[model samples]
Target: MMRSNAAILVCVLAGSFVMAQEPDTKTLFKEFGRSVKSDDITLSFVLLNNRTVDVLFQAPGKYAVRARANQSTTFYVQGMPEKDMVVDTKFFVEQDGHTYEASSLNIKNFDGNTVTKGTRVDGMIQLGTKLDLTHPFTVRGSHGSVEFVLSPEALKLAEPAPAAAPPPE
Candidate 1:
């Protein structure tokens, strides 16, 4: 009985040590939405391993996502009900072995149903980088500001690789 107890304790300790060495990779998924008059606007996102990000936007029953060749992506939202609305957006991304900020995105809604947009840049900043799903950002409009964060257990989708050039004939 004593031997069995000792073995069990050792195994538990070893397992804990091994788990500590592993990277803290958390998946995230989140959604935010609101109704304006008869229109509805929503934003959803999924992030994995700080490597991949997928964002979906819905406005007045219309849904769309932003995708690109490189790590950077841009998305636009239209059909807002309030004119003279100001939209503020911010986010972060890793680039050139460093992190950079893509913030202070203020959009003026001249028309009541103007289009607003956001962007995420990940790798090479000059060319643009992927979105940093780890950090939280805010989208402020006439109604109010909606904050977005990564959800636990988010899908882990690998980024698509760039197409290779054809070999010389």
Candidate 2:
């Protein structure tokens, strides 16, 4: 009985993925992505939520940094170094007069030896503070920072999905 129930649950989850009819999946992310030039690096950020963001690093060339989490879930960046650069900085966000920092950062994929260029890593920082997207926010790093003011379209985006719990009054 338990096995059959689990199977049904899996089917329901799988069906959600298969049921996505929107060809432009990027629409969900378009509202949360933004970029700026910070010193030599052109940093971009995508806000997945208050605590989550994706970051990207690019060099002299133009690259589309998709918003999802890896640091673009990670935001996107342009102007990565000509050669590979080491990931040596921390990331943070300043919102509503508070500064929140990244608990962990994964970059320069850790190989057996040194980190390789374009190496991907995963580490998310979630704190007790809930993100209030109504106000403008900033993503800061050792390199520089990016400021983002949510747009009117973001009103719907600001609200959590229906399944999420209600915010504290």
Q: lDDT tens digits, residues 110-162, model 1?
A: 22333444322111111144555455544344334444453443312333433
Q: What C-alpha lDDT values do all the predictions have? A: 0.36, 0.49
**Off by more than 4 A, model 1:** 1-70, 80-129, 141-143, 155-169
- What are the per-residue Cα lDDT tens digits for candidate 2 across 1-169? 9999999999898788755632233654567766655444444455554222212234331122222331222343333432355543466778888888654433433212333444443323333354566788787776577777777766565443345457679
State every prediction's TM-score relative to the real structure.
Answer: 0.30, 0.51
Q: Which prediction has the highest lDDT against the true structure? A: 2
User: lDDT for model 1, on a 0 to 1 scale?
Assistant: 0.36
The numbered model that scores best in TM-score is 2
